[model samples]
Target: MPDDVSTAGRPHIDIASVQRLAELADYVVPFAIRAICTLGVADHLVDGPLPIPDLAKRSNAEPQALLRVLRALAGKGIFTETEPGVFGLTPLAQPLRSDHPVSLREAYPLLVGDLQAWARFDYTLRTGRSSFEYVHGMGYWEYMVEHPEESKRFDGSQAAGTRVEVRTVLSAYDSWAGLNSVVDVGGGNGMFLIGLLSRLRHMRGTLFDQPHVVANAHGLLREAGLTDRCTVVGGSFFDDDVPSGADAYLLKRVLWSWADDRAHLLLSRVREAMREDSRLLIHEPVSFPGDSDEVGKAYDLILLTMGGGCARTEEELHALLGGAGFRISRVIPTPMFPLVEAVPAT
Candidate 1:
C-alpha cells in the first residue's frame, strides 16, 4: 500500500509484483547453491577464477549446464564473472566449501534432497502433525534410524554448528562451572561434550542419545582424548529414564524436535530423575516477538515439516516447562540462542 499503489489500481505495482516473484522463486537460490556444492564447483574455484571448460572438467559436470547455473548464481552475488565464461567463488560461496570450519556442504543436501518430506509440507499446515511421517509413513526419528548415513550427515551438519553454539552457551552461562558431572541429553557425537570438557577439565560428561548415534561417539571421544571422564550412553529420551544423580542435565537444541506433548514427556523424564539440587539447562533458539529474520523463520519451518517441532516463545516454553515440573529461573540470551535454566519444581 504505497502512495503510488492505487485501489483505482488496475493491477499491483511493478515493484510489488516483482517482489512477489522473487519470493515465489526463492527456491531457485538455494537450489543453485546446492548445485554448486554438489558439483564441487567452489572447490575448483578455490585457487582462482577459471574458464567454464576448466570448471566443468574439474567438477566432472556438463560445461554448458555448469556455465548456465554458475551465471545464474553469479547474478545472486554467490560467484563472480570477472571475465565472460570465467567464474570464481565470492565470499558467500566460500562457506559452502567442504573445508570451511562451519561448512554447509552437507546441509545443502537437506534442502534439496529431501523431496518426500518437503512434498508433504502442506500436510503440516493442514494437520499440525509431522509432514515427514505423513509422507514417509514413519516418524522423523524412526526414519533416521532406518537411514544411518543420513543420520551421520545430519549429525555432522549440526556438529558443524556446535563450534559456534558451544562458545555462545559457555560464555552466556556459568552454571556448568565447578560441576562434577553433566548429562547431555540428545547430544550428537559428543561435539558439544568435547568443547565443554575441553574448557572445563574438572567436569565429567555423559552424552545420551539414540543407540546408533551414541554408538559412534566412543571413537570421537577417544580421538579427542576425552575417554577418561566423558562417556556415551545410548537410549531414547521418550522411552527410558534419564540417568540420575547428575549435577545438571543439558538438553541442547532438543525440545524443538517434537510437539508440546512429546516435548513435555521428554522434559518430565529428566524431571523424574532430578535431585532437589540438580539443575537443568535447555538450549532454545527462541523466536522472539516481531522477529522476522528469514533463516530463523525457515528453521522453524524445517522443524515443523520434519517433526512437528517449533521454536517457541518464552511464554509458550514457560507453560510447557511448568507442566513438566520445572521452573525457569532465568533465560540467558546470547546472540546465538537462549540458555534456559530450570530447577526442579517445589
Candidate 2:
C-alpha cells in the first residue's frame, strides 16, 4: 500500500485538491484588497506610517476587522508591519495610493467592489452572455449612460490603464511626425488624444465619442492645455459619420467592445471619412493564434463579460480590416500595446 493512499488507519491526499485550494484562496485576495482600497487605507497611510487603531479611526472602520484585513494584505507583501501593531507601505502598495499618477485604486474597486457587475459572473459563464448585461439587464455602455456616478468610476478606471499605454504608443509609432491632423474615433475621456496632441505641438486632433462621454473630454482637453489644438464631437459611431479630412485616425482599445459585424460597421464609417492617403491606427492586444498569455486571456473574458467581443490575432485583425476596406500597412510594437497601421485599400 502506498503511504500517500488511505488504508484503514490512514488518510489520502490528492494533488488536485491542493490546486483547487490554491485557486479558491487566490479568489478571496482580490475582494480583501478591494475592501482596503475602498476604505482608503492606502490614502490614510500616505502621510506616514500609522498603527492599526489610527487607521481604523480615520477610515471609520472597526479596529479589529481592519487589522485582520491589513494583516492578510501584509502577508501578500502589499504593506509591512515595521513595528508591533504599526503598518507601513510596501513598494507594491505604492500604486494603490490615491495620489499616484497611475493609481490602481480606482481600478481595484472597479474590478472587485460593490459596483462590480461580475459578482454575478456565473450568469455569464452559464448563459454565454455578458455579466453586465445579465446582471444589469443592459449592456455595459447602456448602463454607464444611465448611471452618471458609475460611469465616472468606469471612466477613471479606464484612464488609469490608458495612461500607461498612451506614452508607449506615442513613442513607438513614427507615423505622427508629419501628420497635420488626427481624429480619435470612440476616444473615451480623450486621454489618448491628450497624450498625442501634447507630444506633437503642430498637430491638431478631433475627439469623437458618445455625447455624454465627449462631455467629459472637453474638460480634460482644457486641462491638458490642448484646448487650442483639439475638438470634441459627440455622436454614435454606428449611426453618425467620422470627421473628414484628417491625416490620421486612431481607434485605441475601441473595436474589441463589439463583435465582428459591429466592428465592421465602425471601420466602414471611418473608411468613408478617411482620405485615400490617411493613416488608420488601431491599438489593442494582439492575441497570438496559439499562445496563452495572462493579460490576453483575462482580457478575453473581460470582453465577453463586459461586452460580446473577443481579442483578435494578427491574422484576425487583417481580415477584419480588409473586410472593411482597409489593409494592414505595418505592425508596430510598444512596451504595452501593439499598433496596427492600416490604410484604405483602394
Runs with alpha carbons beyond 4 Å of true place in candidate 2: 1-25, 110-120, 145-148, 334-336
Compose the digit string of candidate 2's lDDT tens values, residues 178-242. 89999999997788889778878989999999998788887888788899899999998899989
- Candidate 1: pairs in clash: none
Q: 252-312, model 1: which lDDT tens digit per residue? A: 8889877799999999999987789999998867777775553446678778788746898
In terms of TM-score, the best-performing candidate is: 2
User: Which window of ten consecutive residues has the lowest lDDT sum in model 2?
Assistant: 108-117
RMSD of 2: 4.2
- Cα lDDT computed for each candidate against the true fold: 0.82, 0.83
Number of the predicted model whose lDDT against the real structure is largest:
2
Q: What TM-score does each of the candidates earn? A: 0.83, 0.84
| Each prediction's number of clashing residue pairs | 0, 0
